[model samples]
Target: MPAVTSAPADSQRPDTKPRRRVGRPAAAVLDQDGITAAALQLIQKSGYDGFTMAALARTLNVAPSALYNHVSSKRDVLVLVQDHLTSLVDVSAFESEPWERAVRDWAWSYRDVFSKHTPLIPVIAVLPVTDAPKTLAMYEAVSAGFSRAGFPQERIISAIVAFESFIFGSAYDVTAPADIFDSGSMAATTPHFTSAVARLAEQGFESQADVAFSLGLKALIAGLGGFRA
Candidate 1:
């Protein structure tokens, strides 16, 4: 071998070490939908108490700092989640049906949506509808229905709030156990209540909660109809 120059010591040795990347691996392209989906997954897996920005970042395989680049705070993530959930409520009935019928269908759909995401109820209930476009859109549709029904501008929000309160309560009630009203040891002390419970079942109510919700919703629709001009 004529003048075979030895290779550099670094190159001569086997390349055992992995090449270092130039900077932090680029995080997946974060967006409102991706962030909201991750946050929802965290909530579903760990619930509200366990969900956090850090948890969401980990779920997305990104640093917490990277998560902040998209959502400023947990509330921001929640607003996205709320908007997604609210969009599922059926507002199409407003297009063709009477306002009362539209409200009934929308209320039932809304209650069902939140019932499955019960932990979100409190968070979404208190959050301002500002900046939540889907939530606002749903409200807009509902408000227009009320307006077409001749509800006064001043009373529209109050009526909507009242219906929401009832819907929220019914959503929570869905999680109650079948025996939630069972009066085991106190059965003897409360004849009227116990008898009523028995009568509720005897009358073929699907569930105590369901019956209560139906009764209350019917009354609320009728009562709110009174506000129509």
Candidate 2:
């Protein structure tokens, strides 16, 4: 039989590996733009009720401390998201177009953008105009157009608020069900409403929401213009 050598005993082996360093782990590069994009994605997916700092942190694959390095709180992130979305509204019309046309452009574009993000409406409706620079800038542009058109300063905000109320509700309407007015077997008893729904359907192939929105928006523009000095 051949002689064999025994390996070193477990406790007798030398420790050759270096210990790992304790420092910040590798993470995604974060900034306002990245945070806003991630926050918007998260909000679009889970909505406000499901949005949380910890949830956002997980979405970004970073620790909560890493997220805090940017935004101070959830509300800060919301203001960022709000400003970012508002920046997308076509306020350019306010620069070169007449007040009525500017209002129409702004209203239609604002509705279209928010219609896709209706989940943000509730939060935006109650949100203060402060801390959101882009949003404030949009208001400034629109207000300037209104002022040029002779709107009294005192009533400018009221007129804007009225348009916003209609716009937000219309955004929700854009997402309403196609058969929401079907009425089913109960239609026989609700003749007036049933007939109206039928007439609306026969009007055109354009989206019912679009038709109603256009009608309402025209009425709003003409009606709100009455506020002009």
Candidate 3:
């Protein structure tokens, strides 16, 4: 008869319980959607830097290690938040519309998404796109809309890039805090800015903000068409 061999510490230890499943342990008992939702709430309430994995774990009543079971890092959470925002955009908004309307609607939707998550605006701009399906799907739909709008393939892609750049740039400027314009110095500092503000009255621009968006968007579309023609 062969001698009986002792089990390893994990197996032989009576205090240790049997493993629950074959896969990796979950970070939390709740599902991934729940975690992602919680993360959004946290960011909305406290801003990005204010939130931490430890704090999230405390809120979820799980060990911090468990969070890694669902998210790889804070960067991963940021990506998920961006993905969630993009998913909220209505792709149907682009369907059955003329090229200009479809493209404009898409630009407005992109602007709205960024505006809603102002804190994440920079992050979205910088986040590396690694097979992000929702983001890619939005782009593909916009591209298809442009194609149907009679734009050549190159122009279609160019139109999408130009549209996105305009949207992000415009939203960032509009949403930036007003203190940036509050310096007391006149000709001594930012003379060009002072001159620009002075010209605002002469230009009879009652609402520069609204006018800028409309003018920029129209010009972008016109430029795209001109590029192809």
Candidate 4:
């Protein structure tokens, strides 16, 4: 047999590069935006009860351990979502308008944002702003507005808290059915209440909730005057 030269060693081969590994592409690196977006979708579709580290990881196509690299826990993801929601609130009016007007605008914006994420209200309401830079920044702007509007330093937080409580409740109300207060057979026994309900319809407002929210918000804003320095 003719001498058979062995093929050159693989490492010494000419015009040959290492075999390109053909398999699934690497998973995209997880980042805060991707995490926040996935979390929001999961919450919207499944509610808070369905949100979990494992679920989040699955949604991101990664192991649960991978999530810990970016977020310490589910609560950390919540903080991201909360900060994003807060950023949507229109606080710009504070710069040009009177404090009351600015607050009114901000309240409407705040209520609108939270109404869509009602399930998160309780979580965010109690969440501390310690590590949430955007949340802290929102408070700083509102605080400065309140300060300029003559709110006492000691009472600024209280005023903000009170306003937030009303905003949150109003947000929930936005999701209520039009006949949520319908007393049915009991309407006959509660004459005053039944009459009020009818009168609300007679008023020709586009939305009962909108009308109620507007009336209550105006009253609340006016009442906040008591907190001003």
Candidate 5:
């Protein structure tokens, strides 16, 4: 037989370039943690108006369909974001501390977590907890503490809702300017309000938000504590 010339070594070598996937992955490369992290970072940089499935996919170097494999819609991603953020709140306090102390720790932690992520508050506020296991878990922990303290069954959800409304709105307050209460040119006409603001400044605190938060949180705990049996 005629000698067969050996093919060029380079020609026989396998292509080094990555092969394009022909079908769905054997295991999904995207998971909720990865998607939620990317979505959080993207939202922080772009704001909610600019956040989209396409934008998130681009951030992860994948196609939008890849995200759909993990999350059904933008709302699903928002639920993930809310749940992840809630996981950072100090629910551990509910387990170890007295109810009042636990409430303080949890409230402050929740406010701090979302203060940095106020942009997500609108979506988080509306996202249902039915699908957010982690978020629901936080509620469960808090609710258990409430029940332990003899909080009425019918009032638990309502009470938690009241705390959350205060906490979420406080997150926005954290972003307000130090002089947000200043009447400016109208200060002369609003002497009582201006004087109150001036006296608050005289307290030597570094942050107006901190003062208001402390006052509001104290009031909430007192009001809600009455419901505890």
Candidate 6:
């Protein structure tokens, strides 16, 4: 028999150059634009809690580990999505405008964005809005408007805070669950609840609430004038 001496494992192996893992690696897809777009779509459709690594992986047709190479976690994705959305706010677009008009425009723009991202409202409500770059841009824009009008630093900050708070609070109110307002159970048991319901029925609660919100916001803006004192 020919000396079929067992060849070494290495010798038996085909000597073809080890196939360089050719083609774009998974890391290639994790760039800022791709990830940010995916995150924004997810946010717009399902909100923050609905986003997951698995969903993102499926969206990009990559492994979950691939995302970690770009973003640390879903929270990081959320932050990026927020920053991208915030960047659309162009304060300079309203530049050289009157201070009150600038402030009102800024406030309305902020309100519109937050309302669209209702799920993000709570996240934005608590997170320091100044942390994001676009948010900072908006801050600078508002600050510039206030500064130009001779408003002090503290007042500028306060006005920004109050405007955001009012808008967010109203958005929450409109979106709050009806179960939360179920006075039926209490109305039957509590005299205070009963009286309040009677008054609400007589007063046209919905109209009153709408009027109150409008007046309240106007009052808030007027109160900012006091900031100059």
Residue 127, candidate 5: alpha-carbon lDDT: 79
Q: How many residue pairs clash in each candidate?
A: 0, 0, 1, 0, 0, 0
Q: State which candidate, 1 or 5, has the greater lDDT.
A: 1
Clashes of 2: 0
Error of 5 at 79 (Å): 1.5
TM-score to true structure, per model: 0.86, 0.88, 0.70, 0.89, 0.86, 0.67
Which prediction has more favorable TM-score, 4 or 5? Answer: 4
For residues 132-184, write the lDDT of model 2, one tens digit per residue: 98999999999898899999999999999999999999999999999989989
Worst window of 10 by summed lDDT in candidate 5? 24-33
Give residue 13's lDDT in candidate 1 (0 to 100): 85
Candidate 1 Cα errors over 4 Å, as ranges: 1-27
**Cand. 2 Cα-lDDT:** 0.91
Regarding lDDT, does 2 or 6 come out ahead?
2
Q: Write the per-residue lDDT of candidate 5 for residues 74-174, one digit (tens) a residue.
A: 98889888889999998898888888899989999999999999999998887788878889899899999999988999989899999999999999999
RMSD of 2: 5.5
Residue 114, model 2, lDDT: 96
Best candidate per TM-score, number? 4
Rank all candidate structures by their TM-score, best first, as comma-separated numbers. 4, 2, 1, 5, 3, 6
Tens digit per residue, CA lDDT, model 4, 92-200: 8888899989998999999999999999999899998888888888899899999999999998999899999999999999999988988899987999999988988
- Greater TM-score among 2 and 4 belongs to 4
lDDT for predicted candidate 1 compared with the true structure: 0.91
Write one digit per residue (lDDT tens) for candidate 1, span 9-122. 975788888988897556587888999888888898898999988899999988889889888998889999999999999999999999878998999999989999988888
| Model 3 C-alpha lDDT per residue in residues 1-229, reported as the tens digit of each score | 9999877677566765575787765654766677778787787788878789987777777888878888888777777777788887766656887666766777777787777677777678768767577877877787777676677886776667677778888777666654445446555677887777667657886555556778898888777856543
Candidate 5 TM-score to native: 0.86
lDDT of each: 0.91, 0.91, 0.73, 0.90, 0.90, 0.70
Q: Provide the lowest-lDDT 10-residue window in model 6.
A: 204-213
